[model samples]
Target chain A: MRRNSPLVPYLFVLPLICLLAFVFGLSLIRLVEFSFKQVRGIDGPWIGLRNYELVLGQPLFWESVIHNLKLFLTIPVMVMVALVLALLLYERLPGWRIHRTILFLPYILAIPIIAVVMKEMFQFSGPVNAVLTALSLDFMVLDWIGSADVALWTVMGLIVWRETALGVILFLSRLMALDESLIEAARLDGASWRQRAWHVLIPQMRGVIEFFVVISAITMLSAVFAYVYVIGGGRGGPGTATMVIELYIFNALIRTSLPGIAAAVSVLLFAVSLLLIWALFRVRRREEA
Target chain B: MTTTARRSPTGAGMMDRRRLLQAGAGLGALTLTGGLAGRALAQTPTLDMWWWGEQELPGLQAYLDKAIAAFTEAQVTPMLQDTAVVISQFQTAAAAGEPPDLQYLWNGIYHMESVWLGYLAHLDGLMDDGLLAASNHGPLSRFDGHVWRMGWYPLPMPWYYNKDLFDKAGLNADAPPATWDELLAACEALKTAGVEPFGGGVQDGYWAEWYITHGLSQNLDSVGDAVNLFIGDLDFREPRYHQHWVKLQELRDAGFLNKDMASLGLYPGIDLCVNGQLGICSSIGTRLPADAKTTNGRIGCMVLPVFGQGALAGRPVVDMQGMGIAAGSEAKEAAASFLNFLNQPAQLASFWEATGWIPAASGFDDSVITDASVKDLWTRWGKGDPITNITNLMPGQFYEQAAIPTGQNIITAGMSGEEAGELAARVAQEWRDFNPDLVEKYQQWASELSAG
Candidate 1:
């Protein structure tokens, strides 16, 4: 068979390139334009760096940033639990297939459905608290979604519960593709399970681990809107306790109709995401070298 | 010579006659077709209408359908949307200069914002049919001395007490609390009976508006004073406004509010009230009878207890649910005609029967109100001492960014009322600074309000 010409390949991909330019490129340009203007109703007028100043001056914005940073604390716990579960499944333990299916179920569930269920379960007088009280663990009963000190952590716990499935699926696929003979050799050499995990299995899965970390960070930074919105009752409150950058942007845009400030905050969030990705890549490059 | 030219069979004359005959035939056919098309277009004008809140106010869609059927001059297309999506949809339509001919407005921040943006058409000449009393909806329907929207009904937020709970606490079930001190004493009695005295959701944000509006009505003299306070003429730092927060703090400290208020939304709070967990709750008058029925409890409505002597004592904060014609609509006459038809005595009475809401129009038959609680509400509404809700009179930013959040902070973070009041004032000032144009427009409105 004859190969296609180089021009044909470029022509075939031209539509995709055009689509990306029109969708992503144009939106980014418009977003930047909107950030430097005062948008009232439909039209906006140019106003310079005033929107940025206003956004930065808001204490709520800083609080949201702090909340996003706190959510990142869940990454290590999620990764470790997922890796352990995947390793156990790799051992071919009884009911391993059923466990794997159960573990992956939450990943496929819709965010809004999960958020709503979790919000109900974690209410002050909800089933979780009722169970605690019934079990005579009265001291442990808490206002899970209401207290300012506890709401953010509760949201983070929910994120970890829903997101650990993704990590498990990724690690399990990588574990399945591993060489069986290597594990056998390690066992024959009298290496314990923990030692094998530390020396052989963990080293083999470094690339996947790095990829999961980056993706998790990105999700935490920009894609926790539904969780925060539903669980926080759409205001990211009990006094802005669960607020994140996305919620802040939504409140500014939809509730306050301050598109200029929302756009400014969005641009800042984009920068933060870029910085996070860059830092991850730099760390991965160092490890690879 | 003329006779010869006229009778001659020359080639040029023959050609001229043929061209003239062809032109005459073409012109006649064109005129006939144009006339038919114009008549067809005039007979069937298409008008687009968009509305929401049909779920909460059942039978709204049925009423609209009947209205459309009754109006024979135009074909009305009704687009029903969820409450969350309607505002954004209206904004997009307004931007495109092809807004629907008619839209439902909750007549406060939303209506005023649209009016200020020139998205709403003024109904000066159209609303002069004497169908609605000027005093009932005059404050809400008119902005800048022109009617920008036609009010559907006045929704009064009055204090509702469970008569059973009142009796259980040894308080009079027949007579509700009439003063701030009496309300507090009732709360104390309810607390002694191991019951929550008041139920509302601070998490939903609207409860903040309810509290502030209740306080303002008891503290301010007129709607203009409330509007002035909202527009930053009378700052939130004023002692009168600060006193409202102090009163709220006293309630919080007294353990009168529900423990899970910070976690619950409005519906959950309503559930708590209906379940007898709450002794008292503030609710819209339209929802009182239904809420009462759900609880199997006898409920009574009263004005929010006056904290101190003020001009608006015994008045409840009322907001109007209404309709506005879009500025960009092409079928203005047809839309106005539909509105007039819908406001007729029979149709308005039918609406009252279906929705169980007090009608804004005057000629509706009062016999349609069968529910005793609703009838009592109508009697109170007839007294004509209602004040506009602050949420309707203030900017959206003030409520969403400043007041709601500050109220939440007071509940969750243990902030002092003084601190919350100061922060709220700062936020309001910041909003004014950011939107100087809106401030100027508000000042113009204030001047007109004062002159009147």
Candidate 2:
């Protein structure tokens, strides 16, 4: 093939695709196979879809799915917060660099590190409630990480606080690369900041927003394990209140010694994740077109 | 806007020929050293031991390090496992046919699942028989007439009350509550005295587990009865089986548990009693040495007050941690020798001297114990008719999904005792469904235990 041909580009990337297939592909195959078996130690006799039947039939599985759905509520809040923050910074507010760094600091820190600090801070008699009690806001003080009804919400708050930073950075990067001329034209046409953000900049930045939403959807589904692990005291408790799908799968595999059940849940999560990745690709392809 | 692709000269030379040559030289040196080390190590077997304890018992690492050094039979390399990964890591390694020779085994179902999986070697023939018997590995370590693990240390499950708080409440400091009504009366007195009466930190769910360890056994005929509940031979919906939750609920409803109890962890909850902030909480034998010092020996230990009419009521509960040789291990004899060495009278004494806690072996000299509080614990829970920690017999599924959660729900979610029973029954069914293979094994074991 000619060096300039598209086939040459494909050849250049073929090795990585092969490597990825050998690495992740083999495990993915094993994971599906394990899902069909009643796995004990490393392997076990095949039980067909019995693992799936049990996992899906369990109420805890549905509870986990519901919790993940509840987390999906954060994306709208995150998008609004990130858009406003990014737009505000797009104007190059004073000390913007320092402000950006400070805003991004939570994302830079490991989830467990921040989650531990937050767990302590929000404890019933910890600083957050101590301040509330001191200020005569005793009714407002709930068992932040201990009460089942409030623990999942508390986990969501932490997720939003840390995860929104990624959105802010993503949106800000897109905003920075935008056509400033369009915003200036809108300003000249008597468009207010909000109007410019809504009608001009945001409309043009549709691709990044979709990208952020889909990524957040994926995260809330499969990646809130650390937040719940630390905040809910590591067992997704206060009575499984913060039990998301990832923690459910984790408890199945590691804690409960139900590897087949864990694998079944993993397959379900993997399928959902693939859909989100596919959505991510479509958005990217549309933007490129 | 214009963009610059900034690439440094050093960046372009990321894996240059000189660097490759240096890497090759380093690899050659490492290979040479590894060859020499392998030859030197061939005279004696190298036993890999993956253990866990330093998190729960401080100085355990020090004691183990000392023991490993003194163990002359093999070159034992110890890897301290994180609290969460201990079971999974061993099982995973064993499954892969490359398990460490020695593994720290938690009693009952914790290691029994590994036993059932055929990952652990039978300790009966491998280790010293008398020493193994003296180690008190507990009944859960045996199945199909085989022993799986050798006991390492004892965890006596006792409820601690603040003697100072009892006095402050005009209650007898010497006589802790022995009946359910007396416990209620004491809680009332403590409340009147402006002290939080009946809880410790439960945020980590261990306090909840330890509660069941002492509480549920109060209503069981034998440790095997606990197994029957999980294997579907019995149900948690029984009034007697779940009355422990009802008692816990009574405490919650009576405004007896600490207001902050739901937010604290197991150790910190124990601290509430030791520090005189709360009147009572669940505690362990290993904690008594330090806790006794913290409260100036004012901490009183007792079994959870009797409520049920079961045969096991009021018996002291002691859970033991143990060790086993992995079935896949090539150095099984060496591993067994190390476990045997640890249980010997001298090493057991060293364990106590280093960890400030009692070893599981009965051969250890108790005269060396100076702390009055720890001494009392050792005498009462360690000596006479002690029922094994029944929670140790719980299936891991029931433990994480039902047992821990049920206690948590009762305390915090306002879940009634009856509701907790329903939840337990449901989770038990779920466990049976998820693990049909294990259910048959558990049923057989349950029958053998119940008959015993």
Candidate 3:
């Protein structure tokens, strides 16, 4: 009970540790248990691995996994755009504060809100196509969100637009903290803006860039549900063209009443996310070193 | 002149301690007299009702609020559920042994899964036989000689055609196309008149479901035939089973579908017909009042034109939303009593007045409807020999994976009707593989529905 005792500190934090265990620990155990059973109405007879087998056998599950993989393409685009925008803003360009707010507006707004707006804009007869037709570019007008071939790409565009904002904020913070003397020395050496960026700014921003890329990878994998849900008509539709692993799990649990299948998929997604988290830790450790 | 009235206890914030003491003493005296009422008001059976409808059918909450105040059978506390959680929330709570006494029920497999899980009480003994029958609780609500739901409001599935567009195309608006070929001809004429024809929004995927609701039944001999497809006794690959999608493909191939149909939602798609931008779109009865007014009685409702050789073809389709007692409820009798009370004549009329939509009870008086268009719709789709919506019988797996995506793919992505059938069959097989436990229940349900 003494203030200086290590046991006292452990006691002080024990409640929080126990709370975390109860909140997350207990549910995680049940989730893994459910994954091994045929769950109905919160409990069911255990039929080990049947749910996982069924999930793996279904082509729809594979389709969803492929779609999630497709979404990974957004990270590189997000990184490049965010880095360029951050460098421009870092130069203290005219009205950089206003420009920063404008760039970050998509991130500030909720995903569903921006997604709804994007859905409206990208509809076949929506304003975007109307404008395209109004211009001399009639052939460029395509069914943006309606066609199965184009819907996922449209979703990718939305992901990049919104998620790059976080990268911009992160890279700009890192850029501002960089040694200005190094950039000034590059300028005195007659390096161009692109050269200075590639040689001076980006090399120093490796840690923040890696962190942003890792975080965005996680978002693309598990956090794009709202975008796909809103744009793909709440069922990952226009023929499941936008079906992602998150939506696949959602359909299994809520729509199809197959909680066991949902749990199995959730476990897989959790495992994949854990790997990404490990990679993130390695990056963090190296950065600290 | 009225200073005493201003000083009355009923006036806002005007009560003094003396008046408070007097009011308390009055309440105490009332309680003493209330002993003759057989039970203290506090001891009255409390029923918890979790419901959902106001999101789809506005003013439903107001109607239920008024009815709850009017009923004397029990103390009812109604909670309006979110649309997405109506089933899962009830099932989860029921599994945890704390379900609401009464729960809202969507038709067919939506509630049947809960029934199979033993989460809902059968209404056969709890509800009056005559009243329950008159409630039109549909074949899907019954299984193993027990009924599990009491019908609340009916959604008469109708296809709306723009009369103005029809007349503009030199076709008789009074006589809508009654066969598949006639429908194609009508669409051709409408297109010639520069009007989009024969499709609605499928962007939200509900349009696709409604399409199946009307179209699939065109080839079904009974509601059970639809269930048989999911149970694996029947197959969507059979030409007759998927003829409906072929008809949709025919429309698409002929350019009868609106250019933007793939990007619109069910309601906005219906708005195309109502606003005269398109020729025909699938719709529900609840929208007729506003739509009829918007079009000044120029909107026409009809069954989808027939194509397949089946007993159920050319009949109107109506889907009902209902209520059921939770199996875990402690106050089952009170909940049953409240349900019976809702089916009474006055409550049915109040339902009509509050929602301006027809109650599902056969006892509902149709004369209260004044709009000629609405009356026509009710007379044809509601009062005529109507088939229950077969789309309601689809297992949730089939519905989410096959039913919705098939129509969407055919319309938006150039998927052939045969391809749709293949996809549907595959999804049905997948559903069976995923839910082996529910398959036998569906088989038994199919047999009962077929027998009825």
Instruction: Give per-residue CA lDDT, model 2, range A167-235, as digits (tens).
Output: 999999999898889889999999998899889999888988998998899899988999999998888
Error of 2 at A245 (Å): 0.5
* Candidates in descending TM-score order: 3, 2, 1
Predicted candidate 3 versus true structure: per-residue lDDT over A94-128, tens digit per residue = 99999999999889999999999999999888999
Q: Considering every candidate listed, which one attains the maximal TM-score?
A: 3
Which residue window of length 10 is worst by lDDT in model 2 chain B? B1-10
Q: How does each model score on TM-score? A: 0.91, 0.93, 0.94
After superposition, the stretches of candidate 1 with alpha carbons farther than 4 Å from their true spots are: A1-8, B1-42, B132-136, B295-297, B450-452
Pairs that clash in candidate 1: none
Candidate 3 chain B: 10-residue stretch with minimal lDDT: B4-13
Tell me the number of clashing residue pairs for each predicted model. 0, 1, 0
Give model 1's clash tally. 0
Off by over 4 Å in 2: A1-7, A280-289, B1-41
All candidates' lDDT scores? 0.79, 0.89, 0.91
Chain A TM-score, candidate 2? 0.94
